[model samples]
Target: MYRIQEDHLDINQLTQALTESSSECGAIVTFVGRVRGSSEKNRSVKEIYLESYLSMTNKAMMEITEEVQLRWSAVEKISIVHRIGVIGLCEPIVFVGVSSKHRKDSFEAASFIMDQLKISVPLWKKENIEEQGWVWVSAKPSDKQAALRWRL
Candidate 1:
């Protein structure tokens, strides 16, 4: 599921959603994204404001979720939630979870979703810093490279 909210996410709810009922899975990979205090130059940040096209954002995420299912045979569950609007420092921004019969597939798929979300998702963040003023930010080349690896 996708959302654009100001309230904090419930981790227990996410964990419950990710837990699979089937006994075939041995590993459940999870990646949690939090608002970082560092910027492009590793400067300290006070906060970040995230914006996005709500309708399109959910559609894109669902596409990635479907791709995760198609790319790995053992994947049993996938859950991703991204928050938008004014985000506080060190707060959770996104959550990615995947379950698989083996560790390798679950890890890889979980990593792939995180990378793709960073690059492909149409989310924008404006950094609020103490020394400097607010500045809008976009996906970096390193993030693009991370997403590229999955396509290859």
Candidate 2:
């Protein structure tokens, strides 16, 4: 399951829901992304704004889920919730949860989903730097390199 919302993300709720169905699920892994007070390139930030291409983002997320399932056949469930709109510093931005029969599959799948999301999702972010004001956030070279690790 995947959701793109403008409200705050309830990470615990999403994770609980992901593992609710399967009794065979022995491991559950979750990744939560949050807005930071500062980045290497930006400091004195107050808040951030996120804008997403809704339909396109959802499609991309679904594709990522499908790919994860293919790569980790033991992965039983996947839940991804990404928040948009104005997000305060330290607020949750995204959540990715995976349930599987073993820890290894769940861990790897959760990491893969998050890495793919950073690059593949159509989300545009603007940082509200205190002195710099709102500046558009671009894709980082590090993010691309991280995503490249999953190429199949």
Candidate 3:
């Protein structure tokens, strides 16, 4: 399952939902991404504003989830929830969870989902700096490389 919402993420609830449905799986890998307090350039960040076209974002997330299943057949379940709008520093922004019979598949699938989302999703981020003001965040080369590594 995947969702794009503006409300704050509840990590515990999301984890429970993902694990409860996959009791047969032995491994559950989860990742929670939070808003950083500082920018890549080491500047103080007050908050982050995220925006997305809901329909397009949902479609992209579904495609990514499907690809994960195709690549890792052992995966029993997957969950991805991303929050948009203004988020305070250190607030949870995204969650990715994967359950499988083994640790390897669960970990790899979770990582792949997050890497793909970073590059393929249509979400935009604007950082609110403490002193400099708001600045549109650009994609990083490292993120692109990470996603490319998963390609066949």
Candidate 4:
């Protein structure tokens, strides 16, 4: 399952749903990405505004989910939820969850999904900085590196 919305994420609900009917899986790994109070450059952040091409974003997320399932055949269930619109600092922005019979597959799959989502998903972020005001956030080199490592 995958979704792109402006609503705040419900961490508890999402996690429960991931384990529902997933009794066979021994591990359930989940990740929640939150809006940070400070930016990479040490700027104070008041909020972040996320924009996305809805249909394209959903399609890309679905494709990433399918790829994860193929790469980790032991993965039984996957869920991705990304929020758009304006989000306050420390609020949850994205959620990724994966269930598998082994902890290794579940952890790796969850990490891969987040990395792919950062690079492949069509979502843009603008940060409201204390001094600089609103500025568009760019992809960090470290993020690209993280995703590249999975290719090997």
Candidate 5:
């Protein structure tokens, strides 16, 4: 499942849904990403405005989920939920959940999904800084490097 919403994310609901998706799964791993107060640009972030090319972003997320299952055959289901619009500091921005027959597969699949989302998804973010005002966030080299580690 892939979702892009303008409301706050319900982490519990997402995890619960994934847990009930399959009876064969023994392990479920989830990753929750939140907006931080301080960023690498040394700006004090007040809020963040997120937007996405909805159709394309959702497509990419689905593709990433499919890739996870292809790489980890034990993975039963994957769910990704990303929040758009203005989000306050310390609020959840995204969620990735994976269910598998074992802990290793679940953990690895969740991690891979998150890394790929960061680099491949068409989501854009604007930071409302305390002093500098709203500024568009740029891609980080570290994020690209992380995604590169998963090359087939």
Candidate 6:
């Protein structure tokens, strides 16, 4: 499942999503993303404005989850969440969780989900700064490269 909210994410909800799965599981791997004070562009950070195309973002996340399942036999479940609207520095931006029978599968799936989401997810953000002003931060090329490694 997926959602966009201005409020803080619920770790309980993320855990619950990964726990509810079709394939029986033993281990669960999870990741939480947070906003940073600095930008890749090396500018002073203030707040971030997040946005996305609803249907496309949801579709992309679901597709990535399915791909994780198809590639890893040990995987049992996956959950992802991304926040939208204004977010301050150091605030959690998103979360990805994966469940599996073994650590390897859960670990790989969790990492893969985050990497894939970076590029595929339709969400966008703007970096706010004191002097530099607000600049839109799109998905990075490195993120695209990371996602390409998992493409079908």
Per-model C-alpha RMSD: 1.5, 1.0, 0.9, 0.9, 1.1, 2.1
The local distance difference test score of model 5 is 0.90
lDDT of 3: 0.94
The candidate 3 region of ten consecutive residues with least summed lDDT is 15-24
**Top candidate, metric lDDT:** 3
For all candidates, what are the clash counts?
Answer: 0, 0, 0, 0, 0, 0
Give lDDT per model, in order: 0.83, 0.90, 0.94, 0.93, 0.90, 0.82
Clashing residue pairs found in predicted model 1: none
Q: Which stretches of candidate 4 lie over 4 Å from their true place?
A: none
Q: Candidate 5 versus the native: TM-score?
A: 0.96
Clashing pairs in 5: none
lDDT of 5 at 13: 91
Please provide TM-scores, in order, for all candidate models, with all chains considered together. Answer: 0.92, 0.96, 0.97, 0.97, 0.96, 0.88
Candidate 1 — worst ten consecutive residues by lDDT sum? 1-10
In the range 1-152, model 4's lDDT, one tens digit per residue, is 99998888999999998887466799999999999999999999999999999999989998998899899988999999999999999999999999898999999999999888989999999999997899999989888899999999
Model 2 misplaced regions, further than 4 Å: none
Q: Give the worst 10-residue stretch by lDDT in candidate 5.
A: 15-24
Q: Lowest summed lDDT over 10 consecutive residues: which window, candidate 2?
A: 39-48
- Across 1-152, the per-residue lDDT of candidate 1 in tens digits comes to 54556678787788787774389988888888898988878888998988889888877888888898889989988878888888888999887888888989899999989898888778888999878889888678999898998888
Cα deviation of 104, candidate 5, in Å: 0.6
Tens digit per residue, CA lDDT, model 5, 1-152:
88899989999998889978567889999999999999887879999999999989988988997788789999988889999999999999999998889999999988898899999999998999997899998999999999999895
* Model 2 collision count: 0
Better of 2 and 4 by lDDT: 4
Whole-model lDDT for model 1 versus the true structure?
A: 0.83
Error of 6 at 103 (Å): 0.7
lDDT string, candidate 2, 34-53, tens digits: 98999667487789999998
